[model samples]
Target: MSEKKTINDAVSKRYEHGFVSDVAADTFAPGLNEDVIRRLSAVKNEPEFMLNWRLKAYRKWCTMKMKTWASLNIEPIDYQAISYYSAPKTQDGPKSLDEVDPELLRTYDRLGIPLYEQKMLAGVAVDAVFDSVSIATTFKDKLKEAGVIFCSFSEALQEHPELVEKYMGTVIPVGDNFFACLNSAVFTDGSFVYVPRGVKCPMELSTYFRINAANTGQFERTLIIAEPGASVSYLEGCTAPMRDENQLHAAVVELVALPDSNIKYSTVQNWYPGDENGKGGIYNFVTKRAVAHERAKVSWTQIETGSAITWKYPSVTLRGDDSVGEFYSVALTSNCQQADTGTKMIHLGKRTKSTIISKGISAMKGQNNYRGRVKVGPMAEGARNYTQCDSLLLSDTCGAHTFPYVDVANATAKVEHEASTSKIADEQLFYLGQRGIREEEAVSLVVNGFCREVFDQLPMEFAVEAQKLLEISLEDSIG
Candidate 1:
């Protein structure tokens, strides 16, 4: 097929690669039973204590019901029909990219993350996760030199259970939310990083996740803990091939920053978005939170462009005196995509401060919402918050909304909020076209400029990729 024909066909089909893999999978019989949980734990060779923890979470999830407050209209999920565990049929994960499956490498290359791995392997440390397992983690020896513990969550569970046990679920508890409870129950794999006291990581730590199988949910749990005086920057990228059946991707990420430490978490989510008609796409329901302990800091930056249905709120709790929290986000939804995302900041420490900047872009019947909250506790004297939410409507068929909630308990706290919604001005586009830029390029340039604040917050590697993603997502939004 011609390239244009292929693009048109992909748009018509909704899911680009929804085909099932031929590899035999170790799957649990369609259902969410205790036996299924036990078998999954056994397959992972998890310790008995972890099994008990899973059981507790499973029981809690069973009693909970689906939430209906959000503006999402999702189909009822049949937990029984999903394959809880599916991995490429390999006896042991490849030690290097050379030994890894060629098909997997091709997928990453297509998604623009292979170069990221190549750069990381050349002295930069990366923990790359394909489907449910960590494929290759480069520069382990070098990272170890600085006393940084960077490895898969499963590996950390086995090698450094003491650290895992001490901080697991500390930031986001087991019963935090419905999706978090489910993730706590069935999370197969994810990354774990622990920067020891006073040691700054030599390089950026990153995880590239790809979901390749059908009816297989991607429930990964990420936990990062920076001890006293330590600092680290972590990046997470996600992609999935096209599929007809809606896939559930429920993940939980918990970050903890101890005294005098700082943690920066960045995410660029490009999951498979169903076609123009919204046939099949991933239901990305994720819960991510961080706790800034005494005099610590945490910042969250995200660029969301894909996923047919996305519901996420990355939040931070300023629990220590003189701590800081920040959130910068750009959420783009086009062609029937729906996203209700933002952040929450809870100020409990004295002199705590938070800044929120959110940009929402909607086009072609898409719906986007920025729902956020800022809370100042009674004891949080001299707390301050600044919030800004702006929306860009690419077409008349799309919709954008913002809901900001603020509760101030301390009289001395200072808070400010500003929001605006605007459409792409025809005059602006015409002026750019007169300046010799093509219509598409003009639109992309304007959209990029609109999202520069959030893009600048991402790491250098991801900032460029995020810009490219925005260009692709806004291709048809222009005249």
Candidate 2:
């Protein structure tokens, strides 16, 4: 117990990336209407079809009510008070890191984001999004040689509208949910990737999102399409400066894997959580989904440690025979943070299979909820699914809940679920302290040991980063 309190003190420091940047920005008035949608479309110089799509989404969003059935306690949001769009006033928009504004480059550099071209040669291609626009993209020429299209969503809209039009809204339609509809209406910019048939991407594709301006809602939409026999891996990371008022973030991500292809997507979300009193932070409501065609596979791995309130469910659909889907996640909530997140797997074709593993950690007055669903359709003969959910509590004031739903329409289908809840006992900490390990090291060791199952599924680089993130997020809970 002594070591546990010491370790909690180490983790309770303020957020690392809480410094706001000062840069000239072009921002829209705090309001939403058809005019705002059209003006945003004009700013992007989108095609007529794109403009029509946004309008349709706006009309639908206006009629639908935000669902609050999840185990999250979020205050009502005032859409009219949020600036729908905010972008840096860059002259002609910099095409590369050198041409980018020095202030913006410094912002990313301070955040430890690699924006320099030399980093591209080390097998990482990055697209950096600041506020509402993409400021720089590295290694475009190298990816072009292999018929891979990796750039900002805006670039995809301009250069490859046909591709975007074909896949956009296919996996999760505009009316699928309330937040998704809102995102489709006002989304500014995000990353887009296309891997051609039979070609494995040469390097890992990544995107880093930074929310700089205050009172601005970030609505970035990401779409990735992998052709038949192609494969790719993608990474997404985000952070926001500290502020006194809660900021709203609604984003959508879609993935499409054709026959015999594979896609692996990973995220490390470190959005700012409010102070101990929960006075300020971000309301992160996001929708992420993927579709797996015949013999294709899609895997989602995420580690979330910030945000005042988070409600998300990354899901997958097995649409063709023998397709596979997977979801692995580790979510930690400390202080007054609240999170209700999990995944859904829908098996539609024959012999489909899916695996889900989730780990939730809560401390102080935080709340963590895991809600998941698995459905095997009538045509999905021989479908199989396995789900495991585990929760760890560091303080008696915190709470953890789990809700798992399973539906099997065919007799040949099989489904299984397991759940466990545990608290950090004094004896465990005492046992570790007797081994001569430092308090922080002991805490990290215990936390890592608990999450080893999900960590093994992450990429080599991402695994290390996630372990460190877990240690940092839990540092202050005990003190």
Candidate 3:
């Protein structure tokens, strides 16, 4: 086949996860108000304190305006037109996988995530969130044996109120940003994890988020805390059904790594980027931050390949001596998609360190930008930071840009930044073609090689999946 024809054929493939699941849902009216928050809190059976907190966040959000970024051109969101809560009508707090609805299980099965423990990946616990509620959590008993607490946010609030109240907004405060504040007021469900002191979680932990309802926004809150000498790794994935009208997904994630502890958080975001003309898709806006104490470590790795418009910056705050933070990411945008994503590192203690590595690939009119910041405080003596950003453009219509911000308040701090932009040159393609390589496969190989550094940081199993996703996202950009 001609190279152009091959590109067109590949790009025409539909998003595999775009089909909607037909399940009855108890949905709220399309509007936002104090009453809606109260109803949401009441439905969840939350305590008085939780209700008060949501009220406070909601009031603040009412007075706040959405912050505008120079690099992002997003349409004005009609908050009153979005349903803030949607849950499976039959959900009654399933005690086990079997108690969950069969249709919900089938939905996950179609998404390649098995809820049944025996049929799922070994040593990996999963929490499946459909719409705005957590449908099921697998391997709870196994996780409990190791003194770990892994369950839905609502469950954590009901079972461990003190812990939930203590660490919920400590990392990302209630009024951190507009979307986060909105989430704080009406978040229906998400995952909560706690690793006890001196205990390392026995297996990998994951959460899969699916937005199956139309005109209903999904707001979920996740909190993870690692006590001293504890360690854990967590993963998150997201998807949404294809629709002609854009949907909203605003989430918040907070990680607290106490002294001598370690935490790793990764995300695989595939939220159904709109069709070639960008008629519809999810508007993904999220806030994620981690606080690392003395001698602690926190790392964030992500593979972002979907969403019509993405605005996110997962960050880390080094708050104790000898603390370390790392951010690794690979973002792919194609077919009218736009992405503005990166990380932030704040060094506040002596001898703190941080590293950032980012890769961006743009094809077929996709626009990708990386904006990051590295800061060293006056007390952060001997602190260090290194940042590297690379962008690859697969077609003449696509564009990539980078913005780096650095602030050094300590003379002893050492910070280095490096960036490069490149295109898939015809000469390089010819070099591979001369060796009998097909144009499509050659493009995939080159793109994968360009992204290997970031992919290597993903878990072994996820790395392979990420490579395949990258290949599929690039199939239409060869022209």
TM-score of candidate 3 on Cα atoms, chains taken together = 0.97
Q: On residues 317-396, what C-alpha lDDT tens digit does candidate 1 reach at each position? A: 99999899999999988878999999999999999999999999887778999999999999999999999999998877
By TM-score, rank the candidates, best first: 2, 3, 1
Tell me each candidate's TM-score. Answer: 0.93, 0.97, 0.97
Residue pairs clashing, model 2: 8-475, 8-476, 11-475, 11-476, 12-476
Count of clashing residue pairs in every prediction: 4, 5, 0
Superposed on all Cα atoms, model 3 deviates from the true structure by an RMSD in Å of 1.8
Candidate 2 versus the native: TM-score?
A: 0.97
Candidate 3 residue lDDT tens string, 1-479? 55544444443456889999998889999999999999999999998999999999999999888998738779899999999999988746788877787899999999999999999889999999999999999999999999999999999999999999999899998999999999999899999999999999999999999999999999999999999999999999898899999999999999999999999998999998999998899999999999999999999999999899999999999999999999999998888899999999999999999999999988888899999999999999999999999998877788899999999999999999999999867777678889998777777778788988888888775787777676644445556
Report, for every candidate in turn, its global Cα lDDT versus the true structure: 0.83, 0.90, 0.91
| lDDT at position 261, candidate 1 | 96
Which portions of model 1 show Cα errors greater than 4 Å? 1-25, 95-99, 115-123, 473-479
Q: Clashing pairs in model 1? A: 14-275, 17-242, 18-242, 18-243
> Lowest-scoring 10 consecutive residues by lDDT in candidate 1?
3-12
List model 2 lDDT by residue over 317-386, tens digit each.
Answer: 9999999999999998888999999999999989999999999988878899998999999999999999
* Least accurate 10 contiguous residues by lDDT in model 3: 4-13
